[model samples]
Target: MIITRAKEYCIKILSSSNCKKLPFHNLSHTQEVVEHAALIAKETSIDSEETEPIIIAAWFHDTGHSKTYFGHEEVSKELANEYLTSVGYDTKKIKIVLSCIDATKMPQHPSNLHAKVLCDADLFHIGTELFFCKKLLLRREWELEKIKTYSDKEWHKINLAFLEKHKFKTDYGQTVLEDMKLKNLEKVKTILSFY
Candidate 1:
């Protein structure tokens, strides 16, 4: 029931909250990550207890974006903590959820199975057909935030670097998602050839 409430809370906070700035990390992305998190948890065959926190974490993971551009993970933790505590969630489970949220940060360092699942789920799009569409949204978001402006070629090059350096930390991600990731890499290379 808490998981359902967490999802509802995510939708409410993200939709009605001052999240206009988050083009990429908005509700859709959070929902997709939650979906992927559940799938990865089942695929990896973790216990139901462990799966619950990961799902809640996924729902709240990028919520920090509603508050700040950088360090959203910390903000997300604050939001999760506030809600979970008000609902009297277990301290241990809340810790796991916070850790999983932190694990979604870039250059992820997941110390446990729950973290690994959340991390992979957060980046799950990079290995799916949705990558190109999602990448454009992220690029637009970055440009909107004025984080860094990149020419088309420059963006492709950066994506190449990120794709090269990024490895799926979970075995299911490494094996199941790796195939499409390689294909996406090739696609990016081909697109880059035109520039």
Candidate 2:
């Protein structure tokens, strides 16, 4: 029920006034992440008592992308708080939601179960077939911002570096997601060597 309601809210929010600035951080991405979170919750030993907050956090995780502002995880948290409060979501749950969203920042080290769930779900595509598509979306987003553009080789190098340094901290993440992630990393390495 909470997931359904949050999904509805996410669709409505992305469809309304918040449509312009978010090229990639739009409703579909939110939906995908929420679905990923729910899957992780079910597949792992995570408490269902905490599922509502994680789902809510996933729904609002990128709401700040609708803003002209950049790197808006903090702004995402604020929007989540306001929206959750306005809709009479439980205050304690809202706090957990906000914290989960905030835990997705670039230098993230999620300190709790909810935060770990959000972090892993937000990155769930890293091992999927859509990994390249997600990477392109991010690159295009950077291009839109007039940030430095990356060549194919440069991008692969950067991605490889990231994969080399990154490790899944949660047991759920390690057990369920790590092998595919490593496979994806190897694929990237192959593609880079070919370039």
Candidate 3:
């Protein structure tokens, strides 16, 4: 399957030396997004045909981090297009995968169901038990990049605002993950209060 081939390609790209600096956007993160995409696809009863692009998008969405972090989604989309075309994947399906990758960009806006699933899957950790740990890794990445160091309290407020502004676009995300996300928000709030 094209999706299977895409996954293998994604793994190879992510494991290459170019991705060594990506502490947070590593292979594990891509795998997690793939798992989340599958779960959301199943819960939403998305057919296999529709699910293919979503899964492929999930794998390639963060692969751009291998090259650069800023504007990574555009890079990811370009890379996805190059890879899918090289593999002789359907041009229409490649377009769908590109759209899904674009939907994963920050302040996500998904125009279709598959994009919605990809968006939610890409951010599934925001509601999971691993949220804090994953966030710490992101913080570390920022620090390493000298992007802007934040105090623990400052990070709490930033995280609080982010969580407050973020909304799960899909029914499955809202129903299954929204409450947990709210809890995570509250936890951040509580930490901020203590600070």
lDDT of 1 by residue, 113-181 (tens): 899999999999999998999999999999888899999999999999899889998988999999999
lDDT of each: 0.91, 0.80, 0.90
| Preferred candidate (TM-score higher): 1 or 3 | 3
| TM-score of candidate 3 versus the correct structure, residues matched by position | 0.97
By TM-score, the best candidate is 3
Candidate 2 — which pairs collide?
A: none
Write the residue-wise lDDT of candidate 3 on 85-125 in tens digits.
88888898898999999998889999999999999998899
| Model 1 segments more than 4 A misplaced | none
Compute the lDDT of residue 96 as modeled in candidate 2: 86
lDDT (Cα, 0-100) at 77 in candidate 3: 93
Q: Count the backbone clashes (under 3 Å) in each candidate.
A: 0, 0, 0
How many pairs in model 2 have backbone atoms within 3 A of each other, for residues 3 or more apart or on separate chains, i.e. clashes?
0
lDDT of 2 at 50: 73
